[model samples]
Target: MKESSSFGNLWQAPTARRLAHATSQTSPADSHALGRLIGAAWVVVAYAARGVLRGYLGDSMQSGGGVPFWRCAFGVGMQLGVLPALLAALCASKGGGSPLFPTPRRLERWNEAWLRTPSGVWEWAFGYVFGLFFTFDLLLVPMKTNVLAHHVVCLAFHGWVFFSPQRPGLQLVIAGEAVLEFGTGGSNLSMLLPGSDAVRAFFVLAMSASNTYGAVLTVRWLRLQRGRWVWLTLLPTILGILALRQLHVVNEVYKRAHSPAPP
Candidate 1:
């Protein structure tokens, strides 16, 4: 008790107490309810905005009866929009260590210092991703099982951090995800405009590089935890699945980029 209070005093975080006694004092039920409400709200707003944009863009935006193209556009917009902030946070956290190999202290500060804010970049990004993916998963395009699974896993981990009062490795998960999705916008654009070989090439390079970095970071973080729990092992397994899917996307993009164009 004394140690926790002093720690809280050191950081002066308002939610620190709640974080310390998460299972008891912090009402996860309320957090879950509010999170769902916020996610649903974001989905509603995004769809309305998409509708407005589709109407304004006219036939230029139409593809597969206007579903797939806009879905990609929403993804591209969300991924690129939140990326700058996420990258800035990561760079700030990486300052004290080898940029490629983050040290334990640096990783701790990334979560304790920068990500301590209750409502900021992480929350906003989560809401956007949850809403955008849910909108697509349920309404816009339900047939894409791979995409659906990706969303499910992405949200599962993120949702844990968002709802749980005590977030042990918040920054690592969010930063890794942000980095992994860095090239996804280009991938979406490639799908929307298959003729744009440059975009497809960018997706291939970005996914390859970003996913590689994300995987390494995840491994380092898991090692830092010293095999804390068996469940945490799921991180690498899920990441491998996602990485393979992304690699498949990259391969397809490469093949299409090199293949002959229709006459």
Candidate 2:
């Protein structure tokens, strides 16, 4: 009994008591922080999965009686993800490095941007929505120029997969895409969104301009991680396309509610 009392007194000493107090006081802050971290992670996962499924099945460009292009879109998307993964695995098997975790030399400057990477929610959302819509857009244009225009723009979007949507690069891409579309008559989607051609053009241009200025920056911080971390960097870049079309859906519904009866 006496030994237990001495030990308790030792813990009650000023230094030990302060340490204990600090540890006890940290619990609420730590739990709150952990909760926030989990919430953000959940939101990101939802966005990525949303992007993939929507890319596979969502439709954007069709107006009336258009072919259900999503069926074909699903096939194309499967090819995009599956073919690359399989090829990487096959190459890794032959070379003796795991496909997922590539060698340091193979990935250059991957770790340099880890702190600034996004969770790839917007990018995937952009791709899936664009693919679903553009597939229909391609079908709408009977002329060779329009078809070629759509093809080239979509190809360029795919290329952005390698370039992180670090503000400067993403801004340029959006401006470039809008210009290419307007020049190529791919501005066809401009008309479908509850407005006249002039209004549509204005809206498209405005949205593109806004995105160049507005989309949230992907790099929340500057972190140095391993090179395999580059793959994570590539993701936000790839998935980080404009979410204008998706956001427009909400805007349209809101307009419809307010002006449900247009004479």
**Most TM-score-accurate candidate:** 1
lDDT of 1 by residue, 1-263 (tens): 11122321443234433433441232434544544565566667777867865665433533322335656676677666655443443333232232234456655655564345444332344545544565464665533566666667766766665566645565556667776777676676666776676787787787777777887767765654434563466776768766685767757866776888688
Q: Which residue runs of candidate 2 sit more than 4 Å off their true CA positions?
A: 1-118, 139-144, 160-263
lDDT tens digits by residue: candidate 2, 189-252:
3333335646555654655544443232222111222255653754354235445333553464
Query: What are the RMSD figures for all models against the true structure?
Result: 8.5, 18.9
Candidate 1 deviates by what RMSD?
Answer: 8.5
Q: What lDDT would candidate 1 get against the real structure? A: 0.56
Model 1 alpha-carbon miss at residue 213, Å: 1.1
Can you tell me which runs of candidate 1 are displaced by over 4 Å? Answer: 1-45, 53-67, 86-103, 112-136, 226-232, 261-263
Question: Candidate 2 local accuracy as lDDT?
Answer: 0.37
In model 2, residue pairs whose N, Cα or C atoms come closer than 3 Å (at least 3 residues apart or on different chains), thus clashing, are: 55-128, 115-223, 116-219, 123-239, 123-240, 123-241, 124-239
Q: What TM-score against the true fold does each predicted structure earn?
A: 0.64, 0.25
